[model samples]
Target: MLRVAIQVKELISSNVTSALDSMSSSAKMLHQLQREIEEAIIALEGERTKTERNLKRLKATLTQNEMREADWGDKAKAAMDHDREDLARQALMAREDCREAIASGKDDIAKAKADLKEIDEAVKELEAKREETREQAKAQSAADADKSGCSDAGASTAEKRLNRVSQMEKRTEFATEDTASARTNASVDREIDEMRRASTVDAELAALKGGAKKAPAKRARKKA
Candidate 1:
């Protein structure tokens, strides 16, 4: 039973370490860890029950031994009353054996009680650690969700900006082309310059969107 308790302690420690290092797969890891802790608790409880039953049996045996010791003592007195020294000696020896047996039985009961205590302590520790791990998993899940939300919001903003730049570029092209036939050389040069400026703005917006698309991947790698 003590060995089982030690094994459970080690399992809990290992589970805690795993929980701490978990990231995207934390939910799955925590679920498995929870099952392990519960199994350990069940095992500890089984040991506790067996120890309790053994302790009860030991106490019952000790009680019977005490009664037998008393009976032997009475028999010895009766033999002395009948003037039989040999029978009295035999009765006294039987009572001594019962006394020895009672001492041994008491020791066994004490050891069983200690074993039960240790098992109970192990169960409590496992339960507490399980709860702590659950809390950690919840916090991790919330953090992951928050991060995903931010990433999505950034991507949405980037897409909207890109769309607005595309629309503006299209409008500028259509307007310039419509007025092309009526424009002089100077006017045409100004239109070309305007188109160049619009292209630069479009390129900048595209770069922003590209960076936004890569941001989530970078965060994921860092988390890993």
Candidate 2:
């Protein structure tokens, strides 16, 4: 049972660490973690039920032993009253055996109680961690939503800027001959600036994608 508890603890720890590290898949990971914890709890409850039944049996046995010991004592007294030394000696020996059995039963009951306590503690810890994981998953989902909203807002702003630049270029193309050369040069400069901005954005996006890919690969290696 102790070994089983330790294994559950290790599994919980690993799941939590992996979920935290893999933000993109945190929801799935946390869901899996919750299932594992529930399974562990079920297993512990089963063990607890068995231990409780055994404890009850042990107490019943102890009670019967005590009653038998009392019966032997009564027989021993009756034998003495009748002046039967051999019968009295046998009764006394039977009482001693009952006493030994009572002692062993009490010890067994005590150990069963200890085992139940340990199982209860493990169940409690798993429940608490399960709740904590749920909260973390909620927080991660909110963070992802915020990130997506920010990205959409940025793309919208970039689209509006590009539209304005396109309008300016159209106006320049329709300019009179007197200012046509100057407008053309200005349009070329604007185009160059736009290309530079687009290139920079693409490079940054590619780098972000590379980092995202590396994170999972690194996690896979660690898991292996």
- For lDDT, the strongest prediction is 2
RMSD after CA superposition, every candidate: 44.2, 39.0
| Candidate 2, RMSD to the unseen true structure | 39.0
Pick out the ten consecutive residues of candidate 2 with the lowest summed lDDT: 165-174
Q: After TM-score superposition, what is the CA distance of residue 175 in candidate 2 from its true location, in Å?
A: 90
Highest TM-score: which candidate?
1
Off by over 4 Å in 2: 12-26, 141-224
TM-score against native, each model: 0.56, 0.54
Clashing pairs in 1: none
Across 129-200, the per-residue lDDT of candidate 2 in tens digits comes to 778777876886676666644455644644553343223122222224558678769978878866765564
lDDT of 1 by residue, 127-198 (tens): 888887677767766766666444556446445533432231122232246565565577777778667655
Error of 1 at 150 (Å): 19
